[model samples]
Target: MNDRSNARKEQRKKRYQRQMARQQKGSKRYQRTRLNVARIQRYRANCIKNMAHQVSHHLVADSTTMVVALEDLSLKNMTASAKGTVDQPGKQVRQKAGLNRSILQSGWGQLRQYLLYKTFQRGKLLVFVPPHNTSQECSRCGTIDKASRRHQSGFACTACGFTDNADRNAARVIARHAAYGLIRNKQPGQELSTVTLRPIPY
Candidate 1:
């Protein structure tokens, strides 16, 4: 849905840019085209917010779900500019910029906010586990090996050869951490170590 919206926005943006280019800088037509571009941006933001609300509502409305776990993400750090100082330019600047844009567009922060309120209203617990090594750790064997994540989508543990989708494996790791903390009656904000997570049957 976001991809389609982005495509449409791009098409309209190009058309508006062309129209603005043909018009005088301070002309009414140029100002109107500029407003159109702003409107497109606003529409995209509204769509993202709506999607976040829908997703958060669905998760909170699940009867079987008692706790909703999410990564304790730091968007400011994750989306920090990768363009280093002129003396020492950053590597993969373009790639990092694109990643930052995608992260912002995905509305992760917005989704988290929506989930926070919805879960509270629904009387469901919302927990955030540590974000470190969740993807590299094996869900079944509890091994943490960078080599286990051979690709973006696949995870194959080197220690026990446990295999699964990378994202799913990370989710299981997060779930285990949350479950372990709750079972031990750990206080909120107490650290949960990925290394201490127990292996369970897949």
Candidate 2:
């Protein structure tokens, strides 16, 4: 029992060492390491933005009276969620496992910006909706609760037993929000609130 306990402690110590090692920075000689990383991040952001533009434009250009409903995610909350959930140690562990940086690197706002201009070019309206309970609210039955979602991509409502893809449900909720003129109304001091479309190039 004593040997078994010692082994367990040794194993845990090694695991923690590995975790700490993964978080280490490059040497002082590599002071510009962040620049290289930033360039790569910018590349990824552009690629994702282009893809979003292509997808948004394709969806809108083919349909009459197209409205691109999207989420108006609070940048403040976005940053926080990217770091760690407010009440979970597992989230911190997940961060150590590489989930956190992906959230930060995703640049969702930038993708939305690219999509916005592209949609306008195709003569389609892009709408931003407040993201309150998009994941929890059931589109088919209007159920709003935390337990409705099984995962990030699945929503199962208890109120009406409505089950749908999570992303699809979110899109539906966003459409509902769009109908409420959320995109047009700006928060007291947001740049997106001041956004307007230029004439599409003919």
**Model 1 lDDT, residue 187, Cα:** 73
Q: Candidate 1 — which residues are off by over 4 angstroms? A: 14-24, 185-202
- In order of appearance, the predictions have TM-scores of 0.81, 0.58
Clashing pairs in 1: none
- How many residue pairs of model 2 clash at the backbone? 0
Best by lDDT: 1
lDDT per residue for candidate 2 within 1-202, as digits (tens), equals 1335435644655554554456556655343444544554465556656655665555556555456666776666655555555476454565444543443345456557776787778776777666788778887777789988867668889899878777777777767767557445657776542323221110
lDDT digits (tens) for residues 1-202 of candidate 1: 4687688887998899899899999988899999998888888889889988887877777677778888887898876656666886788788888878777887888988998898799877887888899889998989999999989789999999989888788889988887876768867788744332221111
For model 2, the stretches where C-alpha displacement exceeds 4 angstroms are 1-43, 81-100, 180-202
For candidate 2, what is the TM-score?
A: 0.58
